[model samples]
Target: MSEKIALGNWGEELVAKKARCPKCKNAKTLKKLTQNFKCADLICDFCGFVAQVKTSSTNDINTLPNSILGAAWGPQKERMDAGIYTSLFVVLRSKSDKNYSIFFLPSELQVPEMFVAREPLSGNAKRAGWQGFLIDTTLVADRFVRLI
Candidate 1:
């Protein structure tokens, strides 16, 4: 598998093992959903809480970045229009020590202003014309709940 995929899988595994569901308070109940589920990566089987996980290797695990690249813009926009927003789990791995710090951004704190649409993919690229987004962490930095 690609390094990106492996890193993502490792981050998800860390979350599944360490993070507890805010709703149900169960750590083991969080299941990794398929990649097809664009809106979320982990789901709580007990409370039905869904969260999108973003993993990044950073120099400082204690600090959250100003921006985080997000998934497809279309589905996120659709959900935003319908007033449905998934919670976010940001997993930051220390580049030097390889320790992880997980932060949770509740769905209630998410807003359209936090999602900035990215330019569409080039025609020559696979999945041409597909667009993504970036989560503007500056907008909700103070609201994140540290889970680990």
Candidate 2:
């Protein structure tokens, strides 16, 4: 019996938040003092249901697919909790070769500028862009997994 520390610090609250919802398949955002992992403007994938997720729940976000990670899609966009679910289509430029190689981001991120693509893609080009070679993500991942 020594010290009775009053739990009043903001950082303390973040330590308490551990519960995650497996049904929704994700973890809560870092404790933002706002509590409750919510997205009031968020729309559902299975149904048209609109609601916010309580961040207090202990959800292991890594269990979900990589499609939802750090991504904001659709009209409203809203906000989302990220994990392995987030992915990005990054364009890297090689000065020596003077070519652009589109790589998946985060995991594939390297030194910036040095790893930058040849040029920024215009919206028109993005819609109908062709890098000549068509390498599918699924194919690459599957091959890698087999090698492992």
Report the alpha-carbon TM-score of model 1 versus the true structure.
0.96
Return the lDDT, model 1, position 2: 87
Which ranges of candidate 2 are over 4 A from the true structure? 1-78, 82-86, 105-148
Candidate 1: how large is its RMSD? 1.0
Task: Pick the lDDT winner.
Answer: 1
Give the lDDT of residue 17 in candidate 2: 36
Worst 10 residues of 2 by lDDT: 2-11
Where is model 1 poorest over a 10-residue stretch in terms of lDDT?
Answer: 3-12
In Å, residue 86's CA in model 1 sits off its true spot by: 0.3
User: Candidate 2, TM-score vs. the true structure?
Assistant: 0.17
Show pairs that collide, candidate 1: none
